[model samples]
Target chain A: MSNIFPEVANKVPRWILFGLTLKVLAIIAGLYYYFTPSYTRAGYQPVQPVSFDHSLHVKQVGLDCRYCHTFVDRSEHSTVPSSNTCMNCHSVVKADSDKLALVRESYQTGESIEWVKIHDTPDYVYFNHAVHVNRGVSCVHCHGQVDEMEEVYHAKSFTMNFCLDCHRNPEEFIRPVDKVYDLQWEPEDPEWEEQAQAFVHDWKVMPPESCSGCHR
Target chain B: MNRIITVVYIFLIILVVSVLGFRGSKSRKEPLYLFPDMDRQARYEPQGENPFFEDKMDDRLPPQNTIARGNALDRAGVFSSGFDATELTDVAFNTGRDEAGEFLKELPIEVNHELMELGRERYDIFCAVCHDETGDGNGAVKNFAPPTLSSANLLTQLYIDQSEGEIYNTISYGKNTMMGYADKLSPKERWAVVLYVRALQRAANATADDIPEAKRGELGL
Candidate 1:
């Protein structure tokens, strides 16, 4: 301790040392929030290539999400539709539009629309499209009432606890596959629906809820 | 110079003591391990309170480390799931049949004309590559040829020696050279393909006389 400074020989008062330590900590606290990223909405919402509307396709056109995003029930990704999927109607249906031009160019060049992904789990979270889809999760459960959205927002704040709550008690939040994807869907009668949801949700599926559930 | 020497001596002493202590701990100087009676090894420290609520382990741990006992360890939970072969068999046999068992009663399955069309598409992708489009055994696999899954011989044997669920079980988990559809087909698709397979078998056996003329092309004689 004496080696640190010549002043170390002096008997520093405990109060003076504690007060200086607190002042240093306060300055550090002031700088901390300044550097931290904004915690609102998972801190990432990069712009997508095209302004796509979920409500127009899902609610109005009555297109099931699985139509365009074909592999959701069978694979890892609820894959972005290929340009051809868009062009299936776009090429002939909207022949004059810029969206059609972009589609035509992608069809010719074989590059896809550069869509920035909005929904993302952390790298550690191991989610499967198959388990959720086949086991009665509707697409709307995580994706929100995407069919009703004008511009898709982060459907809900999909946090670890948010997912585990349903996973732990699957039937409560689980419903017919048709209604799974709705964020805005409240059960018609809160008490009756809550009881019904509880019946299935109470099945007590013991999911791996620790670090490895998502991490590995 | 003296201070530096003193500091270095203290560091060396710490390094030596730590190494010796680690080695001593590893050696287990108590030789009573061979005789369980002479040892305190049998004494069970409570494996800690609330074992269930604690974080689970890799599941690959040895018997000693495993907390699982009795009901929890009976079978892989996957086996109990609707997707598993055994569970699927039970559901297949119980549901989807009426009195005479002529055809499916009402299985809790969703039907999309698009998805069945998708079933037709994926059946072409996966099933046809083996079962052949005509439901015959002449698929284009280089050397291996699987049995005709669409044959009346296999399909018509109601209770088929093996239960219907057992057949579904076989399709899912696979048998002989057939790869299990567990990886390839979703549970719904697997069930759909089973229905589609039945349709193919019925078609394979159906003659022109059996069809009501109007729906013949759709049956594709």
Candidate 2:
């Protein structure tokens, strides 16, 4: 007991220990939020079997979203293009290209390519593409500028809070029905804010913010 | 001792800042979950194989005769007849062509204002994406150079004189690279779409006299 420990350590105040613990906790919280899939999945581009380039098809080729997602407006889920749909053009355009091997196989065998789903919500949450697309919500709103994306990824987190942020104030997102497919569409005019507000009223887009609205 | 405490504080600050800067980074590994809660719940994924069922396939077919909701044709007054030969004289609702193998000229349903409006709306939804809004065939997919419905040499005489039944057949069964709408659209809606296509053809090849005399001046016709 001849002062083996440093006298300074024994004399240390409890407040400093408390402060260090608080700092360590803050660091843990920061790391937790940073590592969540919502942040990491934003740029989570998966390698598709066909190596399909949305930029080439959508921007340069000018294909509409409905061309591949044929059932966006008619069905709750946006159906992926069937092999027949792919063969519509691939039968001639890139019929023998090495890159289109899977496309050819799928078309010939009548089997699906098994494209990986990037933007998946919790099984509890129900989402409808028809409701959003019909109400003038552009695909760009959630999917981002898909026309520019070489490979598509989840542009937005489909968390309850992220969804509620829009459902609460839909006027900020509403646009004309015709501009739904235009990725570059924006409120350019000075009165656009007022116009968007008017549109929300005119279309009667009252998205529910309650838990049952989506959970059910 | 004070220097050591300051060093610890600096290290903690650096750690927090570095973690915060990792936002939007891509990770191949799955995210850490505190509460799995319905996320990792036991359920069969689409096309998943399971040994629990006799078939061992998760994708089970619907019961022998139990139709899915909204799929019963009789309820919707939509019949899925391939050919209507009940009345040899009546060719309506028939997918078969006449003795000459030519498409029938008369539409099965009468054309009216309401039907035309409905046709236009449905046409915009289903056909306009590929057929183009003006039916000029300059649909958004021009890069692939899909066939146009408004080609003067193609649609003007060809589609215009092809007969309504032929066009209807094309819409129902699909022609060439175009996918058929028999599954997506009902029989009556298909007829309405045929009428709308005819209307588009007329508009595409319209002459000066085809317009109303009063509206001619406004259009500079």
Candidate 3:
């Protein structure tokens, strides 16, 4: 309080002043980019042929995504559930509703329901649900909080570099099956968790090591 | 004073970290063996010759089954056949007795109505799209082609008379264009479909006399 620097007059140096200004500018730029919600591939809220409430059907009703999107494990394209699957339940459940009308129309009309894929990655990037899920890649790692989404929306910034961040070190991002595609998913027990962590850290998994891991 | 304190703090940190790191490296790994007393302390130990370092320690260990008069741990895991660690088998660690033997020593899957019903449900859910409600390959996907399944001669030989294991194998590993239903159906469900296929075979070949009391009028057989 009373002239702390008694030996030398309290003075700010020129270089120190310049350094402070540069640090402040860097902090400002970093914060701006970090908080910005903008992305390269904008979210696709495309009006699907049937206004499918993924939340109502998948989450609320507990109708498994597998029940509708059957080919997730076996095939390249997780083929849109045929109208027949819809007709299985909707044949009785929502028979009067407009969703059922669209489904029935598809059956009578034999026209395919154009479902706008929510989590669409690039064509070159070969992503398999079976291998990724089986190997420990979380659904939320790619798909975001799908269970909560009323109409599906892209949750994560799906850039190649974004994927490469996880691909580089899979153990950092990948998790068990129950946590996959889940929002508030936590590992059930600590014993299983320790085992899971051991499995991940011990085994080597890298995209660069496995070309088909990404390419195929 | 701050500069001296910082330098002293850093020096202390470096010492602590070096100690911790050296100790940690050893703590992380199992010490395979102590270095052999160099057969008269040598001046230079090069590559494979240098023992008990991180990279070359694997070579320092004596070969499996080698007789050791003094050191006994060197011959550790000799009987394990090249593997230093004991392989953890699921069956051995799990209940000691044969697991399947305890559950269904004899496959208790008796020919029953419930199995047929389950088979029918699975067949309708999976196979009906390509192989119709009847065993005829005239499903919704068939586009009303020449009945691939209706031929009685083929149903008798290809499916009905074949061993249950063979039918199961066919369902597990698909044939031609038919995708394997292993992913879709469980092992029990696959067998169930095999049972349903057999039932369908019966329905196809049965004459009017074979029609049941309740369904005789319904089929007009």
Q: In model 3, how large is the Cα lDDT of residue A192?
A: 66
lDDT (Cα, tens digit) per residue for candidate 3, span A31-122: 44332222322344545677777776554454445555565555555556656666644544445786567788876775555555545544
What's the distance in Å from true for residue B9, model 3?
A: 45
Candidate 2 is scored at a TM of 0.79
Measured over all alpha carbons after superposition, the RMSD of each candidate to the real structure, in angstroms, is: 20.5, 5.6, 21.6
Output the worst ten-in-a-row residue range by lDDT, candidate 1 chain A: A33-42
| Cα lDDT tens digits for candidate 2, B1-221 | 66776688779778767764555555444444545588644676554546898756566788998987645544424433664433323445546366677777877766898888868867886677567778866655554553443212224576677888888888888777676777566677777888888888888888999989999999887
Q: Which candidate achieves the best TM-score against the true structure?
A: 2
lDDT of 2 at A167: 93
Residue A35's lDDT in candidate 2: 54
Candidate 2 residue spans exceeding 4 A from truth: A1-11, A21-25, A28-32, A35-37, B5-21, B28-34, B40-102, B109-153, B176-189
Tens digit of per-residue lDDT, candidate 2, span A1-216:
588778677656665787778777876877677656566556666777778898988766566787678778877788777677766666655567899888889778755677777776667778898999999888988888889878776777655677888899998888888788889897789998898898889889999988799988
Each model's fraction of native contacts: 0.00, 0.28, 0.00
Tens digits of lDDT, candidate 1, A1-216: 356756644544654575567556755754442222112232333445676777766554445566566677777667677676665445334446774677778767765565655565544457888767766667767766667766655545465667877867676666655454444556676575666555455644445667776667
Model 3 misplacement above 4 A: A1-38, A177-184, A191-193, A201-213, B1-189, B192-221
Q: In model 1, how large is the Cα lDDT of residue A71?
A: 73
* For model 2 chain B, the run of ten residues with the poorest summed lDDT: B146-155
Ranked candidates, highest DockQ first: 2, 3, 1
Q: Which candidate number would show the highest DockQ if scored against the true structure?
A: 2
